[model samples]
Target: MTSAAIIPSTDLDRPELRRPMTDPFGRTIDYLRVSITDRCDFRCVYCMAEDMTFLPRADLLSLEELDRLCSAFIAKGVRKLRLTGGEPLVRRNMMSLVRSLSRHLKSGALDELTLTTNGSQLARFAAELADCGVRRINVSLDTLDPAEFRRITRWGELDRVLAGIDAALAAGLAIKINTVALKGTNEDEIPSLMRWAHGLGMGLTLIEVMPLGEIGEGRIDQYVPLSLIRARLAANYTLTDLPDSTGGPARYVRIEETGGRLGFITPLTHNFCESCNRVRITCTGTIHTCLGHEDASDLRRPLRASADDALLSAAIDRAIGTKPKGHDFIIDRRHNRPSVSRHMSVTGG
Candidate 1:
């Protein structure tokens, strides 16, 4: 693994850079999710089309620029930083970036440094990630059946992903399985998937598929509201609502039978945007204050314009000022097109 050069700069220590980022809704934005790359190893039917056109390497921000931009956010009181991607692990020398950002964890400037991965590469990087002050991670796994997994991911191997999950568990990393509740594909597997995840002492989060992009398949056929899933599960199992949150949009409940926690991300059936406290930055340095909206501010220009962060900070402030009260995400037969033209991979999940 290549080691990123760690440079101590006075830019983040400036008095003007210490203010907290607050949105127009009076919510303190402390969480920042950065997509290190738009490239992934899997072509999940809901996330991407079978044939994808990724961004060129030159279009992506270098590790140094990403570090600087993240540092600016850390200075602005971002307590949690999540490195997301089409698959963050697939990026070359990604550990170097993780290593560089681990300094914030040591200095008490950040509360958490983690990532959401597909788990295909976790077997190789889990140990190093655990060494880098990362205590937990979220792995996207839609189905547990080998054949069903392959069908959903399009090119993934179930055994390999399972191996990666085992590796992460052995490396002392708390794993949360993020399953996109697909309508006809894997809806029947929800109970078994939840049982398997909870049986391993891991948390399971069921996410309602959002209408993000055109993935060759109609999203109306794939969209499954979590309200129905929750209601169905409540009838068969004991689901006690809990006020616990892990800093994202998931609402949690305790499963009495499994003695484990289960989370629901109901973006469609329920609008959890009222308490939105995070923003996403694509690999190209475009910051989207709301995921369901196309409103974004370009940070790459300001970042490359000067070595100073004044320009970057001002750009961020302008974006946050216009953060929408909530996103307008709807999926129906009439609306076959995506709400946001950009793929969920491009905007960072």
Candidate 2:
């Protein structure tokens, strides 16, 4: 949380460390999630409380600053970039950033460009996004039951999200539906949700509810493990394992003879930290090497002070150097998960 700048005296002439940050399992972390804003239009029960506060716009990073930081990161071996937010589309001129990032794709500097959204504004921006070279999207759709959707999100317009999903698909964007699995809330609706997504040619990723800060307290009692979800799916339909696609954290499986795939992200019950090659940059410009750790490196100060390439590179190196071998949440065997001061909206889910 400190704002002081730490400048390194090293020069940029040193040999570039292009080596992939691989784990014991040989899984490399090449993905980076950058949160553009902490503000969201919906108030999901598991992400925020009814009275949560928002960060001031003045504190958030400007588009130019984000582009510079992104360029620095790309120069440092980060190949894939994911734009996230309380809702990334909520940020002004988001398409402009997309367009700027698209320029990198032409040079093969960025391999993949994606975004995660709550889908309230997705319909309005899908075409512009596709035109800007965004190829993939991940929409968080917890339930199809309109009443349940409204109840869970507090103020989400379900129809709007559905329309957005349709728009994105119409625009030729590869889409995925991200659903957080809770024991009593929408667990029973998994099959229905999967069928819906599959019907639309979109993959469905079922995420195990995680204890991410105080908001997690409301979900602790409702956590649903992967084993239970798999069992439930098995009872309803036959599943086939997709061959040669087991590298990522999500276990990809598909219903027999179905077009859509099912993914499971079991962070709470099954720790995937050993294969975590991804890091997160919050909207406030803090770099989080691990999702479950308290450690973070501030990048805003140096970035704002017109630091030279050497200093910027050194800062990135220091942040990655401090990246823990793995998060200690599971190793510590703690039952009560700590409450994260920054909400997921701000942290980019």
Candidate 3:
């Protein structure tokens, strides 16, 4: 029941420790995104294909294995940890993991622990998560219109998501609304969504759609750049630049009258490779150096074979060293990576 003990820099910089993970670009790797499970309840068109296949349970990493991997990353100087999913809460043992991470937070082994979910199952776990130590929660909510909600999710109800949002807010969790702006779909609802987020005192981020694995053919048509969305927002209100503490790529702005903030994640329009300090691990323990290029090292094999942190750190060092200067998809529209073939869900969006 103690406050966040906060991991100290001294422990990570011990003399006997392995060399810190620094890429060729001189970026210090400290952020880790862990995808606990690949199974998601809702089928969002922009994220997963309508007809999708999930990983078998046997292939998924066990809780103990996940704990070992996480500990190894923390030992290597990772400060911020984000638990993502196809929808993390859908996994039965997610809360136990959350509680364990909460212990790590209280013990100064981890700094910040957060989660990103579709919010379909949030109402049931919001209070427990916040009480345990999850301070930040990002919910992917595209539209407020019930009919559009159903259309985008294929079979989701808007009220349920709104209730989940309310539940998270009630639990005193810092909520950020993540909306994917599509040309014909939720583009027009941007302002409305902003007002809604502002009304609830939450920040909103508008993400421009990218052509990720099997997001289905019309990416060229569906793509809506932030430049256009920013213009629409500026026309209605004055925006002042607001830098974020979270080293994420989203460019944040404060609205004029309401004093609310808006975050724009323009992966296509702008790439944040120079400051990219994060690495992702799939549920099965594959370390993906970059989100765009799928070249990954099967970390599970090494973890299962050995428990030595020094050895684990060496394997991770090799993966971090391989990070490309930047993702090519931003420049090359049809860019394809031979190394990565799975969708964002499997990659842990």
**TM values, all candidates:** 0.97, 0.89, 0.91
Best by lDDT: 1
RMSD of each: 1.2, 5.4, 3.9
Stretches of candidate 2 off by over 4 Å are: 1-28, 243-247, 328-341
Q: Record all residue pairs in model 3 with backbone atoms less than 3 Å apart, i.e. clashing.
A: none
lDDT (Cα, tens digit) per residue for candidate 3, span 297-349:
98887777754555566788888889888875542355432223577777877
Output the worst ten-in-a-row residue range by lDDT, candidate 1.
1-10
Candidate 1 per-residue lDDT over residues 1-349, each given as its tens digit: 4566655445868878677789988988999999999999999999999999999999999988888889989999899999999999999988988998999999999999999999999999999999999999999999988998899999999898899999999999999999999998888889999999999989999998888878997988888888888999999999999999655679999999999899999878878888888999999999999988989899999989987878888888888898898987887578678888999888977
CA shift of 41, model 2, Å: 0.4
Clashing pairs in 1: none
lDDT-based ranking, best first? 1, 3, 2
Candidate-wise lDDT, in order: 0.90, 0.77, 0.81
Extract clashing residue pairs from model 2. 29-277, 213-339, 213-340, 214-339
Once all C-alphas are superposed, what RMSD does model 3 give against the true structure? Answer: 3.9
Model 2 residue 101 distance off true place after TM-score fit, in angstroms: 1.0
> Model 2 over residues 1-349: C-alpha lDDT tens digits?
1112222222222456334454344556578899998878888888877677788899999876787777677766678899998889888776666777776688786898889999999888988888867899999999999999998899998999999999999999999999999778999998889998998899999987655656635455667787898998898788888763423468788787566799888776776666577888988889987776777898888777664665566677678777776653331225554434456776666
